[model samples]
Target chain A: MFIKIDFQSETPIYLQLRNQIIEGIAKGHFKPNDSLPSVRQLASDIGINLHTINKAYNLLKSENYIAIDRRKGATVLPLMDEPDMAFVDDLKKTLNTLIASSICKGISKDDFLTICSKIYDNFREEM
Target chain B: MFIKIDFQSETPIYLQLRNQIIEGIAKGHFKPNDSLPSVRQLASDIGINLHTINKAYNLLKSENYIAIDRRKGATVLPLMDEPDMAFVDDLKKTLNTLIASSICKGISKDDFLTICSKIYDNFREEM
Candidate 1:
């Protein structure tokens, strides 16, 4: 698994790690049932604290992105086919903020949609 | 000014307040140069701590969504016509995570773009 950490970024290291893993999974770098590196190994590889890596893993598990097994540790779960109502609501709330910020920044509707389309296409290509 | 806080939410209270204020601005409930309620007033209104509201206001100021004056307190700033390169980079990083999550949730490209278009249109209507 490939991961990069920017120690200087305002984003917490654990959250950054979580986002990178999700991006990696989306980009086809990690497949369903693929085992993730153990917390100790990943901590050494990324040169972060073991507790930070553990926090990231715990978050991922809670979010249903991955599952932990007694023997295999953490493995990626298959993509969910239907999002729950709560997930949809959360997505809308997030999009609301982004859209507001974009409008305030004077991003044209065409430009904004174009960016969304392009990003969506990038993920589609991986499918 | 209207604000709602869910104590049960996983997101921090300060962030929820910040996002709601941004959404309010985008929806035209808050015009450029409109004065926000004092931190004390808003905190009491929403029944949250004054410190939490202060934190949200400070973050909005740092993001240039609002400005703090000695006497006037925090006032909304006019939207910027040009986003800085750093802002664009941050926007892309956020979109990347959102797009990846959408893909993993089996949201089709059309559906995703439609959602984006609808939200952008909502902001456009307020202009």
Candidate 2:
């Protein structure tokens, strides 16, 4: 429930929240059927605008992370299986774009893979 | 330069452009002092709005990746060194947040690290 916001980060706040929540769910921090803090409460806790928190909630809803009940508030949904093929396809497209751009920039395939490997190794999480 | 836009990406288009340009410079696709396409031209080429292209250009300028000379248009700047400690620190903060959230969600540290290592090794590039 302790979320830090990097105001100066190039990433948008809503994205940060969405990613954090998704990661949280992936790691199993929130159990199925658990209730999320009310949007207003989360906004006050995070000290961000309500609209921003609402935006995150809306995104989560779209992704099926949580369901909104008119009177009961937002409740956590069970984590789904690994990302769908559509999501994987989207990821491939992004990586392909990045790879093509790197090639255009003169980054050899070897160097590009090396950098990514280094980053992955350096940041590997202990699961 | 041809840039593709994903209307459905969670990331902002401007950010995507900024990251792509930075990576491009790192890979040497653009030489020092190369001139970038004008906003209108780039927008037309990419099939995006002029304002979107302008926004990306503006962000690049702020990051010192490009120089905007009123009459001359946007010109690429010399490639900078590896990211500074400040940038590294920011990246660390992000990863730490992701790790902590994962831990909260019941992801084991070993598993996380293994996933990261696999990603790194799988994607490692040759210099």
Candidate 3:
């Protein structure tokens, strides 16, 4: 439920809210079936207009990231069973960029492998 | 030079273009000092309005991903020496979400580690 907004960023407020919520859900901060704060409450908490929060919620609904019900409000959706091509393509592009930057910084192959192994081990330890 | 516009997405076209260009630079598709297609050319290529392309270009310039020269045109900028905290935080958020989804799907820790090692090896081989 902790989210920060950057008013100085070029990205719009609604997008920032939408992205953070989605990222939060993905990162295990928000679990499936978890009810997010009502749009009004979230708007008040974040100090943004209710309309902006509504815009973000609307986006989440459209993206299938959340399900909206009149009585229950919004609930997190389960992750898809199979990854979409678009998602995989986007992941590949991001990894390529991240790897390129690491290499450019003189991080050797062994060191990079060590880092990924650490992340992998951390995941196993956590889950 | 080939870019497509998603007319239906909630994301604004300008932001989409800006992200794509930044991702392109990170993926090594665009080299430093490599001139991007002119704003006019890009606008035509993507079938977006000139103003929208200009907005995207303006954002890239502000982010230091590209330098616009009146006489020389827009040139790609080199990646930063060290990853910024903000960028790393953003990356963590994304990776956490992605990993959670994979785990939820029963992708074992071993399989996940294999994937990362593969990505790491690909980086070394490519570089």
Candidate 4:
């Protein structure tokens, strides 16, 4: 549930921060309405730039993952609204490419399902 | 499967081309050893830039999905080798973020698996 950033990773810093925060939510590290560290606090804690945390927070806000308030910094939102058709379509598109590649490499259907199950279960505590 | 391009889509063109080809292989539209059109020919057929087609083909080659030969141009490869740990790890990392986001949005494990099963079944022909 800790925020760890790999500066050398191919993924951009903001995305890394965003993903970890989301994962933290999924793993119940941060409950709904829990306060997140201010961007300045996180920047100092992680030794990352203030701009990077701001970007990540902004993205999370745009995606409805959090709300930015001047008094409370960023607050987690439950965000349990049903996904729209556009979300379903986008998820399908991404999974299509991933499944295609995995199939080409001979990942069995059962194996693929098992992997999905494992990852899905990893976030079960939150639900 | 037919290759269609949405120029208005936010996804880059070359990625679109590459994903479609991979989908083609997954759906049995292109079998092992099947000859894909040369980069130039595909560029002409799709009305895309030669560079875009070349980039897609190059990515396919690097991923072991196809082979490029001067004599035969590009040929579909079976690419049935079991994925290594690195590939599995990468898949886990991506799925983690996606699953986390979906969970935060109130998608259930059953719904998630059903969605995954639907997509994975889509490529059953190739397997």
Residues A17-110, model 1: lDDT tens digits: 9999998888878899999999999999988899999999999999888998989999999988886777777788788899888878777778
Candidate 1 Cα outliers beyond 4 Å, as residue runs: none
TM-score of chain A of 3: 0.71
Could you give candidate 3's per-residue lDDT for residues B1-127 as a string of tens digits? 7566689977689977876676566556787889998888887877778889889888888767789999887898876766566655655555555555454444555565666567667644532
Off by over 4 Å in 3: A1-34, A40-58, A77-127, B3-11, B19-29, B40-51, B78-127
* Lowest-sum lDDT 10-residue window in model 1 chain B: B103-112
Error of 3 at B3 (Å): 4.3
Predicted candidate 1 versus true structure: per-residue lDDT over B11-106, tens digit per residue: 899999999999889888999999999999998998879999999999999998999997998999998887777777788889999989887777
Put down candidate 2 lDDT per residue, B1-127, tens digits, no spaces: 7456677987788777776675555445666788888999988887788898899999878756789999999988764434455544544545554543344334444554554444333333422
Q: Is the docking of candidate 3 incorrect, acceptable, medium or high quality?
A: acceptable
Full-model lDDT for every candidate: 0.87, 0.65, 0.70, 0.87
Per-residue alpha-carbon lDDT of candidate 2 for residues A1-127, written as tens digits (9 for 90 to 100): 9577789988899988987776665555666788888889999998989999989989878866789898878888874434455544444444544543344334454554455444334434422
lDDT of 1 at B30: 90
lDDT of 1 at A32: 99
Worst 10 residues of 2 chain A by lDDT: A118-127
lDDT of 4 at A120: 90
How many angstroms is residue A42 displaced in model 2 relative to the true structure, after the best TM-score fit? 3.7
